[model samples]
Target: ITACYCFGALLLVVASICDLVSSIQLGQDSGAVLSRPANSSRIFYGVMFDAGSTGTRIHVYTFIQKDPEELPVLDNEMFHSIKPGLSAYADMPEMGGYTVRQLLKVAKKTVPRLEWKRTPLVLKATAGLRLLPSEKSQALLEQVQDVFDESPFFVPDDSVSIMNGTNEGILAWVTVNFLTGHLYAETRETVGILDLGGGSTQITFLPKSKKTIGSSPDDYIARIDMFNSTYELYTHRTCIKYLLCHVIHRPPYIIVLLYTPGLEWRVFKSSCLPKKFREEWSFGGLTYIVSGKPDGESYVGYKLCYQEVLKVVKDIVHQPYELKDTSVFYAFSYYFDRAVDAGLIDRTQGGMLEVRDFKKRAKEVCNKMSKYRPINPFLCMDMTYITCLLKDGFGFKENTVLQLTKKVNNVETSWALGATFNHFQNLKIHR
Candidate 1:
């Protein structure tokens, strides 16, 4: 019996060595190898997909094994994203389907050679798909599933699953914190996160605690005060229901008649204003008036000053025609008239309001607006939300660490999604 046991142990050791050899050989072919002890449990790779309103993002993470007493190292792993801007679908719903197809195509092309299969892919769709009509949303999901079915042609078999918003927020929070140097002890006392995207923004606040050292905490003391006092107001915007109604030309409309002679103003009127204000004040030709600083640097002081610019633009929708030449005047007037008739702008507000000196008015408005405190601090928290989330939510207790890896900034062009699918398909679960 003792001899038999010894033989069995020898066979097991040989099998382990063979597995390591195979992994090393595979790594050599792939140009990169993540080496670790055979019994290490701290190493893991997480691939996350963020389908935002404006685009889709795929992030790959590699967690390195570490001593229990030392901080764990996080490698960049990889990243990719897609951008069509949800606005493409606002006017035409069919464009959403096209956008998804394009996104899948790009995702398939970017996976690492070795990780083309066996990696787990987590997909989370945010504002864009969430705001789409029920029928459209269902169609979008079906299209995504179909694309996954066909992805094997480009890469190979892999697992893909959708993630809830909460999870996306959590993972994003983790990633951001890891990227930024915020995974330190002092800064971990309390942290706030704000994620701004083309369509909507997500805000999260996490308080500090030491209970999450060894195991996941069952209960976390939420910093509700931080959320209510700082985050809530900063992220408010017109609801989707209101935005959709405006786009479809429903009720509760306001119009603005412009007397200016430039097509540039139309672009501003059409694209700059919030959906609520756009619906409320359908702007006219004078909408593009270049009154306040032709260089676009006039309003810099106001609380959420960009929003003030939007409001100022909306206010000028319907104003008296000023430039010379009746033909020019008619062009401006005709466009303004059409805009109002099309339920784009409102034509009220006493006669044409004109500011003779734009620079002076800009200074005055900026001064007054600057006095209002910004709802959220724009500096430290600008791109720091993701970092805050990881540290607070995922119990990432580590000092600052910099990771270098391949990253795709333009998700729309790169095939990150497909690459992610292929990564998981090739993964070999050793445990």
Candidate 2:
């Protein structure tokens, strides 16, 4: 049985690789023009599904390879998204499969009818599914597989699976770099990536200092070969949702244990929340009654909020060496959304801001919680938490400039494209 699973996995990888290479080869005869010969007008498509914590997005990419010697350039991408995520269907696996089936209709309409069998379809679930119980996750995946099996498009055995947190960061890094043209640049100039998702956060970058790699935990440092360049990448999962917000309910004694066990969970408190506010929050199938201290003392400003969020991050997050150095970082997901909500950046066209900018904004937001309450109840807590995550968690200096963006060159800034690139590179089809 184990051997069967391994063999199935191997076949799945080979299928994905072949699907990507065939697409590239299909467009090799043409370099330009719409009035080209039938052979020269060959166009191929690839579909990638990003099942995130917040929503499920489909990226229908069209690629044309003018020269076989050069990498295929992305011609266009048709993107669409639906909310509530596949993880939200943990109990109703059939409904989750139905969601995927609904998204497949978009791909069917986007790709040529004759190309349905040739076009490859894949879905990569993120931390949302990872946070679910193993059984529930498996059931959801199985349902997705069933839906794929029923679809007209080519579905590889590994078409649907939960992506690793580390690879999540790496793929996002590749997508941003590729879009920014850094991946194919002559020099090794690359920007770092900080992705803050609801269920997890990822920090990935190329380390310039030897101390950064040497001091990091063995697993935190990963080496990946891509774009014909081998890169030693540093990834820190500490900022992940696993530890970031687990502070609210932890018992004082097990505070050392951190993320207090599920069985021991009780009413959680933190200054990050409004002093008089208390609510029930749900995540990963678990609900917690969380609130600020019930004591008579009123929580006034970011001072207390900062300290509360700090305990969840300080000392636990690794400080990347040479962080004071000016290196461009593209932060997105929750980071982008929060910045937009906080009025730090434009929603349509993102802007640049510094690490200290986030800190300062967080202080202002938290201090004026009452004023912003109508906009978002958790504005203060979320801002303060992100502030601490960047400054204390990442050890970034106040002046560290980060480009907070949602897209680059009109392509949504996420890991879907990078994962697609990985599929394309893994293929080794000889003429």
Candidate 3:
């Protein structure tokens, strides 16, 4: 609802959107919304928990109604996260519940007691839980749901669950575009989004070519009613293709999953690692023996790495799409982390770089692995994989500029706010 709370007509979104809710909590005193104090009753709170694979995070959003009939504002946000996500505690479900309860404390301290009952508390799980069997994932969700049930805040229906990957991408797209003020403009020429995660990667944008939209599969289009206008987003299709394609090898997908388990004793070697480097990496309750070629044929580095990752890039079915025509793109998660790890951009003040920048850096990191060593051995592979994904998988032009942002307007670049907005609209909550 960037252009407006544009989804008034979206409540009956689709058959798949049974539990969806709208995020808006407009005041009953809607008579000519004027600037009010921070303490005004119009100011409200939304509590969202991101039950990600690596960790669970809490985002306490403070929203204010500045223009009841126009754009909404996310005035401020209080954020916190802890490592070892709920999935890590899958065996001991109660421990997973403890994590949820701990994060709730942050919400408790942030939202006022008087408004606690009115605030919407939600938790949306990403791919981490999606990897688990349904029974295991359900146990974890049930554990968190127990915590929410006991909390003082208003828990909407199906407040905690494994989020659909399509919804996940859309919500993240909404978070970045909405915060950047792309939604408020008249042109509505919104930027596309690129997220390179372990199990999945998402590419989303408004198609400039009707042929592109028409050629796409039915699942490619997400038809949502926003205000009176309808939007058919093709993110779901792109994401599915990209994720499946990238799995041709382990390096691209495994290293990207910072939260998944790994084989302890396997000396997995890849051309993507610095040729002379070998190290033990541990995370998510497991260890991995990963190393570079160390000493192999000289024909090892970016070229070999690229060819290996290229298999995954081949999975995409394309039309002369508008990804490049969209002008700007936003890449986050591993894209930002690898960029920061490679010294391509600042961790705090994330900067923009062309899609080819990753290619150039990958060449440097891989070709001269013996000369230049990175702190993370996986850097070479990640950089190479990302380069291939953007240039080959998504079919982005070399000159296309990608804005890498970890946070927007001081709030973490998160999809929870969008989900909250979706929930807000879906619930049609009455104060």
Best by TM-score: 2
Better of 1 and 2 by TM-score: 2
Off by over 4 Å in 1: 1-45, 62-72, 85-114, 152-171, 181-190, 197-201, 208-431
For each candidate, give its TM-score against the true structure: 0.40, 0.83, 0.82
Q: Give the TM-score comparing model 1 with the true structure, all chains together.
A: 0.40
Over 368-427, each residue of candidate 3 has an lDDT whose tens digit, in order, gives 775557366677778887888787877788999999987776767768867876666556
Model 2 deviation from the true structure expressed as Cα RMSD, one decimal place: 6.8
For model 2, state the Cα shift of residue 237 in Å. 1.6
Q: What is the per-residue lDDT of model 1 for residues 111-206, given as tens digits with 9 covering 90 to 100? A: 444443433444556555665676665565555556555544222233333344443333333333323334343434322333323322233334
Q: In candidate 2, which residue ranges exceed 4 Å CA deviation?
A: 1-40, 239-265, 282-287, 293-298, 428-431
**Candidate 2 structure quality by residue, lDDT tens digits, 359-402:** 88888877777678777757777777778877777778878888
lDDT for position 322 in model 1 = 14
Candidate 2, residue 123: how far the Cα is off, in Å? 1.1
Predicted model with the maximum lDDT:
2
Clashing pairs in model 2?
none
lDDT of each: 0.32, 0.71, 0.69
